[model samples]
Target: MKRIIVAITGASGAVYGIRALELLRKMDDVETHAIVTSSGQRTIAHETDYTPGEVRSLADHHHNPRDIGAAVSSGSFVTTGMLVAPCSVKTLSGIANSYNDELVVRAADVCLKERRRVVLMLRETPLHAGHIELMARATNNGAIIMPPVPAFYTLPRSLDDVVDQTVARALELLDVVMPGIQRWDGTSVVPDDG
Candidate 1:
């Protein structure tokens, strides 16, 4: 079984992480391990209808954010990769600086050191130089900083469609192919005549 770690931080878009877990659960060969930070739990409660426990149930295994000794905290855990859905700036700073104070950052650090894919769905806007610098540092350390930006080309009809598409793209970064995600085939663009 391929193991994948999914982390949800204090960022506003808790649904990105939740949706990732839900989609991964349908794949027969994938086993998902989840980490929901305390702030993440609060965010889920405030932004979505599902309780933290309900979100946890979507994954095959769930780890406490404070569990620094968990299996995923080591490079030897041999996960395919990790996805930090809606990664907050705090978590980004921790991972970028290699500060493994908690399970989420520790697991992400492990993945980076193991040369495994680590996709962070940063959920912030109005980027300042500091945010950009953090993203650069994490990128230098082999982390893919992916913000949850929706694509308009998909002609999404609902908020669910937008979230699913963004989550699907994040999963794709980890090489997890989500079926039926809309793709840009270039056929929709019209050539300029002017």
Candidate 2:
């Protein structure tokens, strides 16, 4: 079984992580492990209908954010990789700096040290130099810094469509394919009439 770690931090877009869990649950060959920071729980309550328990129920296994001793904290446990959906800037900083003060960061660090793919769906906007530097540092450490930006070429008709497409693309970075996801085929682009 491909074990994938899905972390939900305190970023504004909690649904990204929740949606990722929901989609991953459908895959028979994948086993999902979830970690929700305290702040992430609050964000889910504020932004979505899912309670913390509901979100936890979506995953095959759930780990507490404070459980630094969890199996995922060590490189020996083995995993496909980790996806930090809506990764907060604080989480990004921790991962970039190797500050494994929490389980989420610790697990991500373990994955990076093991040469595994770590995708961070950063949800911040109007970033300054500090945010950019953190992203660069994480990228340098082999983490994929993917900001959850929606693709217009897909012609997303609703907010759900946008979220699905963005999450699908992010998951793709972790080598987890979401079946029937809308992909760019280059046919939507129009020729330059100028």
Quote each prediction's TM-score.
0.96, 0.95
User: What is the C-alpha lDDT profile of model 2 across 1-194, one tens digit per residue?
Assistant: 99999999999999999999998998898999999999999999999999999999999999999999999999999999999988999999999999999999999999999999999999899999999999999999999999988888877789998998888888888888887676554676332221
Give the 10-residue window scoring lowest on summed lDDT in candidate 2. 185-194
| CA lDDT, candidate 1, residue 183 | 76
Tens digit of per-residue lDDT, candidate 1, span 64-155 = 99999999999888999999998999999999999999999999999999999999999899999999999999999999988888898888
RMSD of each: 4.4, 4.3
Report residue 192 deviation for candidate 2 (angstroms).
26
Error of 1 at 33 (Å): 0.3
Q: Evaluate all candidate structures by whole-model CA lDDT and list the values in order.
A: 0.93, 0.93
Number of colliding residue pairs in each model = 0, 0
The stretch of ten residues in a row with the least summed lDDT in candidate 1 is: 185-194
lDDT for 91 in candidate 2 is 100
